[model samples]
Target: MRDVAKVFDRTGSTLGVMDDLQVALHTYDGCSRGCAGCVVDKHFKNNWRFRNIMTGPDMRIVGERVKEYFHWIQENLNTKSDGYFGTNGYKVDHYSYTFRFGNHSELPQDMLEEIAESCPSDFRVFSTAPSDEIHKFVDLRRTHPGNYFLEIIYDPVADRAQDIRDMVLDMRSNGILGYPEVLITQRLLQAYSPERFVEEALGPLGDIGTQLQLGRYTPSKTRGFRTTQVVSVDEEVRWMTAVAKGIVDRKYDIHPIPIGEYAVTFLDEYKEAGYEGPDGYIDVARLPEPEPFNIANVVKKTRDIFLSSIYVDHNLDLHVWSESMGQHVLDRNFGFEPLGNVRNRPIHEIVTEPNGVLERMLREVVRNLATHPKCSGCRYKSFCASHAIPLFRKWQEDDGEHCYGYLPVIREFQKDRPFLTNMIDGFKELGF
Candidate 1:
């Protein structure tokens, strides 16, 4: 019941599946460590740092099929781990997590060791912010390779600086499993310049983290928090450069889960033979060879300024996108010009894991960049290329995987409004 097939725009038919038990508990939504501005923590306010160790909150588990597994999942649910479906049938997306020993009084080292040893599946994941645990997880990965994986989640801004450094040290201590996965927040990346963020991102931790998800906020499903936050392109560029510099300096063994920035760099170089622009779309011949890092830079720079410009009041122009950013994905992946050699199926999609919702979304977006105004062909394509559907959700709201945030950012810097904007303004001006 935890396995649900979600259709992606790029891939007409595909199944998205995750081991319900591991995925749910592993993805910490409720953390009461009181880390200011932690996205998951803020969204689900609970004291997970010092987890109850005895009882979980009342929030419904993600994979729960209200009509189907409610009673089943609830009966076996261990409120202690915030667990559901302990007794459920063979969990496909089985997960395993490890917490740092000795930090929280709730679950002692004995408990963590026992969990690691008794890992239900051949492949398990360990999520930790503690330094020792990070090293241990890496050690385990060395001994177990792809059978078990490690996901590190230490936010520099959320927790103390020492804590983050300690965690990075642990990753460096064990270089076997590549980079220790760490979560770098927009807040941290923005507060400090991208150079600083990269220094930390590329510090001892090797690969920064599994996913570097960046985006604005929507009204939290949990109330009392208001106001949406957004990041622009320039902010992201600085962030990437900082990371690139880190790679150059630290010699960190970095790996991308979806091959994020790496993929962008590769695809951008190959865009020349592929791009089929709309009528007024600028020709490659008319402009400078698009910078490989231009899009990444814009996203980082714009993001940093937007996130940090807390006092700026440029409520100038706002535009919204439709449907989880489908426009961008569609253009890049599936559709062909019917006049060119572009195949109906995108090149990347051929190699994608059908179970991958994120990959499917990426292809669809690259497919759509040409006409999705925010993309501006190559202007900010890096962010669109690097970011996933999750970013789209920032703008799409409850629209189920869409984004329009960039539309507004575009309007802010736009000295010349397009025909579409002019038409909309003229109507508003006349009160008609």
Candidate 2:
């Protein structure tokens, strides 16, 4: 890892001003859908790895504990500011709950409802597998305005992809809690043609995001769980651009996070520095964001999302801009003291890196929904921050391979300018 050249004011008391009820829940074992490259696989060795929420005293205790977190949040953060309190710390392979209690038709209805009931109804997004039973839960989720969102996750190339997509669309059509997404990664795109697949499977809902976030593969899981087919940034950009354009051309639903802005912004920086292609390789000089990414010049362009209600599961630090990044930090009710620092250490390296974890983290911000680091020179010294956990979980406490798909998306989005400006805009504060 490169040395962290930039210095952060590590002096501040890491005061995390949290919201109402953003707790995190995980199975840690029992079931896994085997996402081609998953971070959860790294923790397979630990006994506590798979806590099996279905059995044991831990699950019973959690059921009650989460409720406490929820009620506490209602009084503190949710009513006014965005004090996120959602699920935290659990490396379950794929699906958390087995839903294996009764016959196929019955499913784990009662228990599932109980789990959902325990979590803060408004402000929490329950990340669940893309199962048929999800629709049932979505119906119930809609009853609560801000509490639940049926997080429908699934692979696109797999056989069940179509089934899952169909069920998701049907759910949306049926007015179910429809914040579902296609968890397609960059590596997966290499294996399959997303353009053709979206055309065939998603049909309409595929139009959700402007660019399907091209996620990267973690090193640990990369050995077996993830493929190490390292594609160059240029090619990655090409492929990502193609997929992004494909979605745009077809008018599919492509909700782009702030990372897309990063890509577009970077591209302009490269061109501004007099870039030129060499030996079939397009080259550009590096003109990184002035020493402090939080220059007033950059912040002048963005808006203030400070008052907005945001989740904080991934600990998305305010200093680090992200695609919203790999997965969102939206409402996860989890413990804070343990997951303080992001797994990706040495923030200095990550901010200006070329291809390592820092670059990837930046890529996530550019491609997805990102919050800019307008805090550099601002006097609003009391405001707290968050960082995406998937990319930095190990640094805090060794765990999973779930955050590697943002690299390509970052490279791709680096070409756009308007997107870049949008991202930079988030940095500026009212007082500044």
Candidate 3:
């Protein structure tokens, strides 16, 4: 059995801890789209000047490296006698990996096929811009079909709606096995109200079994340069809740990513509180405002935010996470530097070496969570630790302020708890 860590709140009540690891592979670093508010654009642009571009053969080599790394992890780390404890002193029991062929650039067909051939078992995600080449993905799916998903980055400001609809329709017509994931950034949410977005965008795509991911735009020095276009926490909450309600309504075959994850959290809190109305129904008014800084909640939120994920960028540089890939670009001494480039050394050597950079940084992040005044007192400290730690380290400011955003959505769901609960139950009954 895997050793489990006990997470406690300020009052010493027990909280749940996570025990899984995820690896994100970035195969390329140059994108031609030049979409608005691209999180990796600046980093990619900077690296393009100095970094060697990865060719198809280079990607295959990376694929082999990743496979060897995973085998080493399973043989050495994921054992009863030698469990892996990487994040905040939490032990991880299982490991899963995601391969994103083009984290920064649009994936070419040859590179996409190389990834497909290299990692046949792993869940492979190809990020590409809106182009006629997207149709080639259908053939890839037909030839090699496992946990493969194509993520189409749709910049509502720059891309046309018809293009998306046409591409999805083409995939369906060609007998593509699974739906392609579409990414809509915060700018689109700001441009169109949640209701309007659902009616105009999500509605058509959802009917076709396309999964939509709402990308939250955070103000980073490199990405989201157009600060004026960023949406507020309130607006984000509105969009998320509306989309979740749509899922509960069975309006589409689409599955909400983080929204569903958030729903599970809110559901747990609702059940634990046991608040009910006169008719034994959930009373939204009776629900208490969540204590974001409560130690147990903070730990759980940090676990959720982190998802025990690590990133390997195009240069074969291992980052703490995908978001941290650009930390050096933001500030050279951001502290969360790449663990070590895989090109120079094997991943196992870099990760398993005693007191290595990765371990030291993990300890440092946990220490900061406990000692940093802003983090110790702030409501969204967990988020700051897990998602925005690099930004926080650079600015010495709280980036987790948006932690409160989940409350409004929870409250809204509570208003229709019975129906929503029944819908979730029905989903289970149908084996979803």
Candidate 4:
């Protein structure tokens, strides 16, 4: 297995050389929040409440299975043969592995503890509401002491502002929450004013040891209730412009997730242009906004989106991507079938086997993306290829109406170049 991994690494194949593997685990069967237009609920054939939930003992078994896979990966995939210069001009010695829990359902303490102990590495815990269980996470952090993230999903319509604020404060008091480690995610809905979203949803949070993630609502076939909530490209561009302007004008202390990333990209471009001022300090305000360029080129230069990450549902079914699992549940014909269940097969076999089902499917997906006429000329091709299968499926289902979900945001970045430049300058001035 090690020899096979070395070969794949040398060839620059996406299969074997993996620096990070994000395994998203659905801990529970049903959610208690019952928020309207829940994506998780749409994954089920019937009501989520009717599904059989995994018990603590069942979760423990799953944890052991994951631990076994992790150990196998550590032994076989973590090291490279000496004197072998692989792709990217480096030898693999160590990599990070993460277990992301409670993405779709509420995770109980017992389940959390079992998974935490089993993995004994970096992990993320998520919650939709304020709970007494926050303390238990703090306790677990003390014992484990690994790089951890606590994600809180705040729905402006469903959750009270004070309740979420109080929860974050409690976590901060316990020394469990900090910048980049604590994330507050709010969904972007259609017709919601970008200014209003910042004022109502983000304003009250007020730099409470948390970063922000603006989640774009994806239209799901099963959940027609949210179909109207899908933001159009125009609206998405407006949202990005508004956020960038807000960051510059209001000087919000919080760092918005991808917006911060985009600002850094622009800043790097500014530096590369040799725009240094007196004393080697570049005057940001004096510099013009970056010219409109393909954001995909930037993404392609940075990293390959096709990293070795997999998803495992509560049923122990392993998938190529986390989004694939949702497609499988919503509509099997449109979905990429699971490579295999972890309960039945080992992780290495499912991922690394030559001429295997997984490899064949991945190759086909890549070929389709690389050959598609729309994708061939598109600026977002590189970024789109990272999520080729499901996105391709959606394009087919929509009769090629949807070019890419993020086109509006990308266009906005180009259209409002001055605002983006100002935002980058503002972040630089604030020492972000």
Which candidate achieves the best lDDT against the true structure? 3
Q: In model 4, where do residues sit more than 4 Å from their true spots?
A: 1-19, 42-52, 55-65, 71-108, 142-147, 178-191, 206-209, 219-228, 262-307, 322-334, 355-357, 372-374, 378-380, 387-432
User: Order of candidates by TM-score, top first?
Assistant: 3, 4, 2, 1
- Locate the minimum summed-lDDT window of 10 residues in model 2: 89-98
Residue 341 Cα positional deviation in candidate 3, in Å, after optimal superposition: 1.3
| Tens digits of per-residue lDDT for model 1, 1-432 | 123231112122101112232221222333334332333433223545434231222112111212122233333332212112133322222222222211221344444444444333344444443445554455455544534333444455654444554555455455523223333335555566655655654454444332222323333333234333333334443444345444434544433222232232222333422332354332446444655544333333222211111110011111111122211111111221111111232212222236443334434555555445445544446444433333443333323222333322222112112322222222221110
TM-score of each: 0.41, 0.48, 0.66, 0.65
What local lDDT score does residue 378 receive in model 2, on the 0 to 100 scale?
Answer: 23
Worst 10 residues of 1 by lDDT: 309-318
- Highest TM-score: which candidate? 3
Could you arrange the candidates by lDDT from highest to lowest? 3, 4, 2, 1
On residues 1-432, what C-alpha lDDT tens digit does candidate 2 reach at each position? Answer: 012331112122111111222234443322345655443423432332223333334444444433443344343323432122223211111111121101111235454455444443344344455666655565555654443344444466564545755665665565543333444455566666756655664565553322233343333321352335434334544555566555445644444443454343334322322342343122433333333344232221111111122221222221322223343322211111221222333222222245643334334433232232332232221111223423333222221221223334554434343433433342221001
With candidate 4 superimposed using the best TM-score fit, by how many Å does residue 23's alpha carbon deviate from the native?
1.3
RMSD, each candidate, Å? 18.7, 13.4, 7.5, 9.2
Residue 372, model 4: Cα distance from true site in angstroms: 4.1
Runs with alpha carbons beyond 4 Å of true place in candidate 2: 1-22, 27-32, 39-107, 138-147, 160-165, 179-187, 193-204, 207-214, 219-237, 257-324, 328-337, 340-432
lDDT of each: 0.33, 0.36, 0.50, 0.46
For model 4, name the residue pairs that clash: none
Q: For model 3, give the 10-residue run with minimal summed lDDT.
A: 6-15
Tens-digit per-residue lDDT, 56-84, candidate 3: 56566666666676676545444423112
